[model samples]
Target: MPSSLTPPPVQASFGDTDVYLFREGTHAQLYRRLGAQLSPGGEGASFGVWAPNATEVAVIGDWNHWSDLADPMRARADGSGIWQAHCPSARHGQAYKYRIRTRNGDVLEKADPFAFLAEEPPATASRIWTLEYDWQDAHWMGTRGAANALDAPMSTYEVHAGSWRRKDGQFMNYRELAHALADYVAGLGFTHVELMPVTEHPFYGSWGYQTTGYFAPTARYGTPQDFMYFVDHLHQRGIGVLLDWVPSHFPTDAHGLAHFDGTQLYEHADPRQGFHPEWNSAIFNYGRHEVRSFLISSALFWLDHYHLDGLRVDAVASMLYLDYARKHGEWIPNVHGGRENLEAIDFLQELNRACYRDHPDTFTVAEESTAWPKVSRPIEMGGLGFGLKWNMGWMHDTLAYMREETVHRRWHHDRITFSMVYAFHENFVLPLSHDEVVYGKGSLINKMPGDSWQQFANLRLMLAYMWAHPGKKLLFMGGEFAQRREWTHEGELEWWMTDQPEHRGMQLLVGELNKQLRGEAALHQLDFDEAGFEWVDANDRDNSVLAFLRKSRDGQAVLVVCNLTPVPRQNHCLGVPLSGTWREILNSDAKPFGGSGWGNLGEVRTAPLAANGHRHALYLTLPPLSTLYLKRDADV
Candidate 1:
């Protein structure tokens, strides 16, 4: 293929204005002018890169038989470190790399930092490409602002595209996966699918976290246009797409951004500041104006070109704290002797601000696993300005309590109820993410402590409790059903397990939970407000029972009750604010969910008996290892 989609040879260069804006770190649309663009005269492609430390830079590819000096590039007049060259011989399908002669007299070939497509791993060559997909999701785009509002109902299904499904032992391409994934997620009633990092990476085992090409989607799945089709198809099915973005660190591959231009240009000079000891990656130099411009531009590229709905930032905790995952004498403190990475703080704030500015309806979530204050608050109020933060504390506490034997669960009652102490500290998403089910941690279902039957019951109860808890919800794929094995990036999920009744029951429970969450305002309308939640009976540790009420801004309310132990509680009295009939809106112990069917027949009449600080009370049967959702009769 030709290096571009144009007609003939023309001058390919970045103007002085482009250099100035890039130097000032204000060029959010740098992709427009940088990288390989079709020539205006319609002949070939314009290749550009930033390599100030290089004595000479040339475009090398199959078109020139990989000759280093076949296509020499010119440096910009401005001192912005940009180089450009027009390759009339380079076509759309041609592979290319920048051959740079470093000041040290070493010639190195590096992949284009702005390449739209790249050859699959084991071959590190940038491809001259163009994206031209006709999107048919205008309705989804126009209405997404309201659909993705903070107060809206959001049940995200976090998925790793490569492992979700496969055919003939091979990964499904983006177009094929789109049709199947959209139908499956939509049928399960998930409002959105949060994909694990889909950025291009050399090592598939990293699960796309160690990105090499920030602007390009992984070719393992499909072409860039095909990934766009994946997003568009989901949009048409009324499902939003949230991509996992890793701006915190990048892999140390030779052709990657590690030592671009034969210097510490993208990362810091010192290992303590730039190197990630745990992951063996390089932390980006967030303070550098040009590097900041690069990262911000990458984020904008996805939203602008791909029409993505949101970005879920990864490893935010590591980015925020300079001492994260480090021992004594292994890290440096800020000027104030604090652990905070001041530069990263500024970058994240600016990132969130720019994202919202460019796309008002889109959101950014922080995968920060710390007690960082105001992580989801507005930047104007001295906060990091993220739309949401993963509720790591809730996930940890709930999982710890659930893993305990049912007989001993009463002793750990506080673990289950302690999350409400600071539930509203920031906007939160109760996430049972991919991290929970990998690296020998066991699958979500396997984490439960009980016999086979009780394990399924416990899994259903945990999910019910998670949905009814005071936050938005996120569950990793295969968690909807009771998959018994931990997740592996190399293989597909155990989809065949769903044929079993117990597994199918868990899937049904999740589907119903999503439906109820969307239909009930009390479940989602005021999730971030303390006033929306009230304790009905949080002090029943002796019976291993807990009850609470979720309220909308309006008068509507739904009561949630849970029995963590296998011993059922009979004639359980829970106070109700309303005097009308309260029906069993959902019972995890119902027969359909493969439970013992120990629940109220249908509804319970609220009696005018003073209990648990309310004038009216309802007597009901609480099933073993189950959660129940009750709603008041609207007709009363």
Candidate 2:
């Protein structure tokens, strides 16, 4: 019997990709597996759909749903504008979709007029397949820096397989995706592919977040085998794959996981623990043992089955609270009297531990925003055991500096400083993701403060500083090109703009930057070491600049300076380690990264005669919004 405190059952159903939770006391673990059980080996039958507004809708064929004809739908009553039926005779082989009603009913939503991988007979969705995929990621290693190789500096390429490519006016299948995505990411120099959820879904606009099937990849892209092929191809190209694991909540679809198998088999038996108030999605009861095993097994399933490198746990903040959206008595309290959702935390820890245990190198990053302590700390330390937690503070702080009034930022130096205190405690990634430039936020390019020239300079300066910072780094797709407009997931990258001098300049800068990142003696060597960092200067707001240094463990020193002013500042004083000639090895304002021609290249600068008391000193002309990397080899 369900508990009286159990939340009301939501109006949703089950399909593939439905994430369920296993609970124990106040803890829950998440699962990321794939599979659909419809009475093992049941004969083919028509799987019906209910899409209102469609004066008429039909069932399309077929995977392993044990369905018959591709066109079997029974209309519904109560004017729900729905139609549904079953196809028991249809085998799971063909592609399918619905003949939904158009606004004018003249032309219906025709199998994604821009459909990439469509089935014949022009259906709406693919039949659920029960086939298996074989994969091998022998060459693609995992994690880095004591952490799993999968958790290192992850510059992920976020992609929607269907809209990412189109040839012959049709969407490509999984095989096509493997080839296309591989080429794109390899060329761009991204290390991982963070694909939009691949869970089987029905809507094109939802971007796969509203999943319909928990255990199945969307047949829209092709077969499950093709998806695996994509991962394999990514590994062959030296790139890793990170799946978007959404265990926080679920979409409320009628034929989905909700209330499936004659009960709330996949969701929480009680309403209190299994409902998400904000997203209107079904939540999981993290207190069930069965749910915990299911969630943990799912994570292991993906790593074992797809040879995936990692998982980016989405909406983690939503999962760690008992009163996420509640204002009153609907929620319960833990032993501490706090309103924390203890079950979710438990499940999360279990999932992290299991993933680490199964594939010691598999990485897990939490997309958590709240000030949850020790989120990235080890499990034995009484913390959630994610391999890396998004350094959201870095993202928000950096973006705020770029967007808000700069004059106000001086007082907010502590905001940026706060990032470093926790940076070394656990693995962190400085991310500039899709969230930064969506809606009214504008693109990175548009966020530039000064004119076009200053904008590019600022962007480059920030990148240079970011690379020099002590932690893993990530930049969103199109950011490398200094995209001018906000991102539109529906459109392809603004590749056409690559021809522009500024855009091309940004591209070249990224390439060379990455090259330097690997070859430079200052970078890539003991970068994450706690002792390798120091704050040399921060009071340069008049010039709107800041300077810092990254020291090698072997005593090799590298100095970085940034000048954000429009006019070059003469004899700018920057405190340094050595009073000798510090050669300028790299500068952002140089023509290399599409900035104004104001830059000094390879200029071994002479230091000031007088010292700053503590370390050696240097006084050099700093260009506006330019970043310079200087290496001091000798102690003069």
Candidate 3:
């Protein structure tokens, strides 16, 4: 249930059920009864926090004049390690922190780990807020259960809200983004918009990855209600919303989770297992029952309170590996002397199971970059139970191949075809995410090896190939319009790039790619099955050309040919199953896409000549540095 409709009782007290569930790691609605809830009497608020190590705890805020001696909390009689206090003066909208006296005699002030709101960054006080909103997205929520299925057409527009677009050099608020961002993404023809983390964090540079408030939507945009409006508006516009969820590690800020109550309650006490050296953060103690409940409650809060369509979990690879980013002596092995983090694996399994059990319409995706098997498989089959997994191997290999000079591309042709080796192993999302466009890596367009004209041409070919490939699609903001500069969290995307014809043409190509991807059943219906794709001529390395066929479940098919070289092939012959004319559906070399205007014009006829083991062949003109999509005549 949403917390907005489930406030605590007037004289709330912890019960045995709460204690049992918390200890058993089954407390999905802990956010509702815990945290600061308004008193049923409407006098003030009831504050509760789990701080077993604290010898004493108090609520300090503006209401108490930040006094450590005022509003002391009492330990629960159920022996649940929870402290609660009913303050008649600490009402809604007041900022507060828990002042705890540790066993070592040190006093510490910490923000509420389950706070529903927090003061914006540079200030670390948790605010008392009642979660309430008039949602208007029932139509979308009712029909979203099947929208993320394996066979559905899902082309996602990966966005960083604070930087997607700005007005007068300032971040756009959620209300403004609700309308503007929704309209823009809809026009681009993407079915979903995946926002970079919006959870409350202290630093803008972390891009919301280093979260401080798990339950609070970042005030960097607007209030929690405003964020509800953002999701609602996007849903109303027919765009599903996905949040970037970071459960791997959290920042070690002083007022944050680290060293709370002068003890490592949230993280493991061992540095080898608890501390993340690369991010300078703390890894959650997934083996702990209360900790698992806390994290699980956070995951459910977004879906229940804000009506989000899905969660794209970040750094899943880090969570799964015990030796991630560590030297030989710097890490500790699991109980079985293995490198896998067994506790995290169990937690993820439970998380996925809970998501499907509680909110069947919502999906979970893993940003896992490893060979961990069956990531998108079901939990019942010993798999991670994610709806989709990012195909990082494909992204890395394809980009590396594209960066090579065209004259040398033939030698590295395997990079283009190798992904198919494991294409069906897991349901994949071919992601060109924000990570690819930042941190000293050049923009997608800049990665192409060529002059201005050829750069745009290569980008067009890459996108067309992505759309026609065997997977769902995802592209980060600004990539569609060919932004010349690498992405930075500090500023918005270069919207002015669309003024140039080359940039405009690149954007147009992306839009058309999305349109075709959604309209053609052969492109998406059988994405995960071997029956959908058949290679026509994958061994044409010398000429830098490859051809394949994509088939829908209904027997509809589309033929795709790629010319990777700068020089055009006048009569490229490839086998076809149908004996009829194949009409050109999309060509990267079309003039409208800023190509060299060299193509088959519109259609090509098949010959009875045998080629590539097929009885029928098509001798067609293949354009340079382009990808062509051709649909066979239905009359055949």
Candidate 4:
């Protein structure tokens, strides 16, 4: 090949505004400019990369027989430290990498950080590809704002695509998973589906958490268009898609961002500030302006290109505190001599701001397991500016309370009741996520303390309690059907378990709970406000019974009562806001849900006698180890 085939560096196709904003750390659309982009009519491609410390850079790919001297890139004279070149022979679907000569004369070949598609893992080369998909969810895109609103009933089904289902011991393609997942989620009445990270990673065992290609979806499933179809299929079925995004840390793989250009260009030089001991990963240098732009741009790219409804940021607590998972003196303090990660905090605030500003119809959630105040509050109000936050405290306390024997549950009643004191502190999502059912923690069903029958009942009761509580809901895969084994990425869920009566009953109960949550305004409309919840009897320790009212803004209400022990309580008097017939909307102890056929006979009337501080009260049967939802008959 003649040397003239490699043209001299020209001005980037993207404008100078992108460069200015990138340097200022405010660029949210760098994907359009910095990555390998196909030229018009697919004649060739334009390549751009940022490697300020590189002494020389060249594009080596299949088009040029992987020759390092074939297409040498030229550095821009604008002092932006960007190298660019045009290769007319570089067509789509060609594997490529940048060979960089470090300042100290060492050479390194790195995958494109902003690649839209990567060669399937076990092969670390980036592929030249185009993102072109004809989306068919115009109706979903037009009105998703209301469906994703705070008051809307949001129940998320967390899934791992590779393990969600496999065909003949092989991973299902994105298109196949899309149809199967959409059918399953819509049938369960869940409003949204939260996918674990799909970003490219060399290790399948990481489950996509140790992400490398920020802008590319893993090719293990399919192409970028395939992933787009997955989202489009879900949206068309009225199920929103939320991606679990990891901006906290990345793996220290040799082919990843650990050391680019023979230096820690993307990470801090100091081990104390750059390393994550717990995850065995390298933390990004959030203090760098270019790094901020890169992270934020990755976040926006997903929502913009994939038509995703929201994002659930992962490991936020690790980003918020410098001392996270580190022993004394093992971590470095911020400039203020505090343990807080000030640079990371600023990056998070900016990320949320940019996400909301660009996609106001969408939302962002934080999996923050700390007492960080105002995590879901507005940025202007001295907050982190997230739309929702995972309720880790609630998950831990509730599980702890449930694991105790019925006879001992009264002593630990506060564990179940304490969450209400801080429930309204932030917009919360009561997540029984994958983290709860792994590493010998046991499946959610096995966590209960009881015989086979009692275990099933306890599982149903716990799920009912989560639905009736004040917050949005999220349940990991297999938990809905009471899978007895712990979750693992290596295998698909036990789908055959649903054939059993007890297991199928649990599935039916979850579907019913979701239906009730969406059908009744009181169950979800005021999930984040104190006024939506009222304690009818929170201190019934001796009986191990608790009752509360979930009210809507329009005065509609649902009365929820839970009996912790396996001892049935007949004629359990509970207060009612209305003086009329109260209908038993749902009963976990009903025969259909693998429980003894014990409950109030459909409905009960409230008498004039006052109880639990109400003008009228109802004496109803509360089943053993069950939760009941009652709503007053509007006709009465």
Candidate 5:
């Protein structure tokens, strides 16, 4: 959170900016939120939202239809709080807001339910114009769909828009955000930016999980047009954008879509079936045709609208379980009650299928943590159908290992090495997500078990291992800089640490890691679908050393040796599959990443034995808690 001393980075960054850092791309907004052009497509469109409470509600502002309606909303005896009215003579290049009469018999300002653009005010809401930009994003997506290089090292930069920067307790706009954020992210060398949910929401907190509008980009940040320009700008810089999407549940807002149309239009009708016990949110009835359509349409809307490269579905475990949030009195037993949200499963499959079918290049990733089979498998072969599933087990297992790891006990081979068993079974991404480091768990940096020096060493090694692992890699924001505090969206990254060299050093390492991800064959295409990665020493836990070889189907391999021990070891014996020379590629013990001045650059060792019908064996000195990648050829 922003410190009292600093008033939080949010105040500094969001300071009256006209844009946000992570805006949607141009041409990416219209397809998601379709609107009928008012007045022969002259420009402005009048929209009416249903908010039944108290009395008067008016569409005020640049529309000028009711800018003077001090108590804009009108009251009805129904007491349902349904406020509706047409914005007369509404047009573009203007602002608006809801002049609503609250239940307390008092008037207050609220943002428009359908407004695409919002200003930080008393700021008038801008009249939104439908995006009709001409371009070739669809064409760009088409090529990546067929055979885009999935083999390139994939290092993703995770971002959160609201907390990324909010000055004066206000949000930034899409236009301002796009240019600044694109330059910042692209300059960092990240191949992709994984943004937290941008879906429209009423509250500023909840990190967007309590979503009210399935398709609307939060007007809290900016306008649809501004967001679109952000996306287009990023694409021009060669950055892939992945949106954080929430289809699992909806917020229980009274005026929102939850009970719109005077029915359970978006969620289940029964309280037992509709609500989440812990979250106090509404669950969808995926079994319903319209519900399924809503979700499927949502997936398409993002892909088709902003031309986002992909989406990462949130809280999939809740969606996967029948009694996810069940309490003693509020739960349902699905035959076995061992988590059988069948409709959710079907809905997932359909969503993935539609995305792939409509745009093969576009990806749909699930945040499911269970042992759900074939999460990344093609839908044809009895799978939930996702381009990728978060390797949640790997995250937990690794974090667990680190918490207990030290210089003395060496390491437990089984505990540290079990993730590979399933990490790559289906296309998966290893993520140190916001879930693992937020709300008191602390940041990934603080998870390490030691003082400043040791902590930095451990973090670098962890990231090295994650990058070299079989699956793709992602790190939540603030983690790159080794922020020693837990995450709170109310503030910007622990920017106070910016003055510390260690913090800035970690940031540099992140930038370099993102660059390294661009062409590392062993990372991108290595065993993406069961064709790469093997453990040469899976059970070598005694020395706290784990070694493995990751390869592509073409027979190219890179050996990774990681030592979790605190003290360096000499000639750590390990198995080798080749008899040729293996040279050192990347070493975490190097000075650039704030290592303990260990590891030799370009050190090469020839294998002494043969295995797997090849003499690919090698031996070399190993550093404590350091990761080194060995390349088999100049090409690797």
Candidate 6:
């Protein structure tokens, strides 16, 4: 049984200009017109959808008792395949779906692609919700350009909101998590917090990567307004927010974008081009004009509505190659007969252009693994336009080298120094991200090859080296305090580990590293320029030692020395650029950092003896498995 009320008169929402831009694939604000939006007077809601192949479409919702025949929509005469309807009884806070009658007489129910809010997982319906928030981050908005500058000190704390922390083993609301995360991140002195995808997805295991709702945030935490509060609160605390966005592939869920209007409207019809073999998902058809508009709109939607600081695009390598995970006969070459995905490349360039053109203060990062050229360069430079690219080569090489026994590390000494050959290839972010700690990979502390004490020492040394390396820094959530196990979405982090002395020391070391990274101009002011780095000593393979200098634009310098072996070295002479008192700014082997307390007694003076191509040298005692930072005293 259905209500006998007559449907409201058809009110067209899309004008000629919107249609032209939408068809031309340049519409960046489709959310304003395509989704279920309430009228100005709050009387009823207007709906618009694109189903060119459908014979009939209707609005089915709680207001009409989920009736398919109660309200029928009209197709535009312009043959743009757009369907429109107005339901006087439909109001805000109601669940709805489109009942589309296919051309061959089949009925399909699909959720709104531009939905602002969606029902929690296991209930696949879109909720008609408004995005009205009273933001109090004007100060952050007006001045974030400086905080997000290329020369700024940028260290990110990567978090998965569902598993970051919980209350009584239950998920915390966005408002509650906002305060908790802001306090913790601000205390650690990280400039930004990069959240694993928050876009709505049906499977929690995918961690928001297999996204279904492009324009909506998962209701598992809270409403759209609640998520807004999360960003606002972080900004007020002087912390920026970056979201992980996935446009590489999508799940083939029935109610999702797959087979919309009884056709492959959003994806490729051919299996070779549409299918993702590894994930068993459907790849997007970037060549389609309307699909391009949809994806670019989704990317800008976050920056426009949520006031986010940036987007870290996930699995960009998958999108750039046609033969990404395919065999020889299982792929299609571009029109130029090459392996490059030309259409996707164009889409990426256009996406970056739109994001920067609309929101100049925000940035976009690429998680590209291959040796793609100039990923972080500008579009005019004939490269993929991104603000930063993850240094996957550095992460893999360093971790592989650390996993080997200390006795065998000297043979692989090139692993630690090879990154310097192409260190300045692109604006890189040295990321120790969640990918390293998942599956059977083990935790960061356990990755070090040594006894308990030596393992902790090695971990500390690695952190110091990463901070002094030639790029920005990113560490996953549990790595800050050395969570003992691999990461799983089903459980929260091991918060009790912080109570232990060894784990607490790791936490303290991270905070100190971040403090020094922010406080010392020589550490971060010229992270991307080779001019900021110099090899003080790189040929000490027998000692398994390495040293380098990080300099600022003003010639201020900090020398970093690493002793990888377990045996201490006494009277080790290291060359210096200046003859003055070198103050020990940081030592990973200090007693407070859960070490054996072997160091150079806080200071060392240079002598006239030449070593390592320098006119002056300093005699020092290097601790076991330690990395130290020494800066020349300006007042001396």
Q: Which is the leading candidate under lDDT?
A: 4
TM-score of each: 0.97, 0.78, 0.97, 0.98, 0.82, 0.98
Tens digits of per-residue lDDT, candidate 6, 1-636, equal 123434445877888988898888889988988989998777789999889998888899999899877777878888888888888888888999998878777888999999999999889999888988899999999999999988999999999999999999999889999999999999989999999999999999999999999999999999999999999999999999999999999999988998889988898999899999999999999998889989999999999999999999999999999999999999999999999999999999999999999999989999999999999999999989999999999999999988888999899999999999998999999999999999999999999998999899989999999999999999999999989889999879999999998999988889999999999999999989999999999989999999999999999999999998898999998899999899999999888888889998999999999999999998989999999999999888
Candidate 5: stretches off by over 4 Å: 1-36, 43-88, 93-129, 134-143, 146-152, 165-170, 333-339, 407-411, 496-499, 607-616, 634-636
- Give one digit per residue, the lDDT tens place, for model 4 in 1-636: 223444475656656787789889999988899879898988788898888888788899999999877678887777777888888889999999998888778788899999999999999999999999999999999999999999999999999989989999999999999999999999989999999999999999998999999999999999999999999999999999999999999998877898887888888889898989999999999999889999999999999999999999999999999999999999988888999999999999999999999999999999999999999999999999999999999999999999999999999999999999999999999999999999999999999998999999999999999999999999999999999999999979999999999999999999999999999999999999998999999999999999999999999999999999999999888878789999999999999989998998999999888888898999989999999999999998
| Per-prediction backbone clash count | 11, 75, 0, 0, 52, 0
lDDT tens digits, residues 579-611, model 5?
555777778777766777676447666656664
Clash pairs, candidate 4, are none
Q: Over the stretch 371-458, how does candidate 3's per-residue lDDT look in tens digits?
A: 9999999988889999899999999999999999999998999989999999999999999999999899999999999898888888
RMSD of candidate 5 to the truth, in angstroms, is 9.8
- In the order shown, what is each candidate's alpha-carbon RMSD? 3.0, 9.1, 3.7, 1.6, 9.8, 1.7
* Worst-scoring 10-residue span by lDDT in model 5: 7-16
Model 3 CA deviation exceeding 4 Å by range: 1-10, 40-42
Ranking by lDDT: 4, 6, 1, 3, 5, 2
Q: Against the hidden true structure, what lDDT does model 2 obtain?
A: 0.64
Q: How far off is residue 275 in model 5, in Å? A: 1.0
**Per-residue lDDT of 569 in model 5:** 77
Q: Rate the local accuracy (lDDT) of all candidates.
A: 0.91, 0.64, 0.90, 0.93, 0.67, 0.92
TM-score of 6: 0.98
Q: Candidate 3 vs. truth: CA RMSD?
A: 3.7
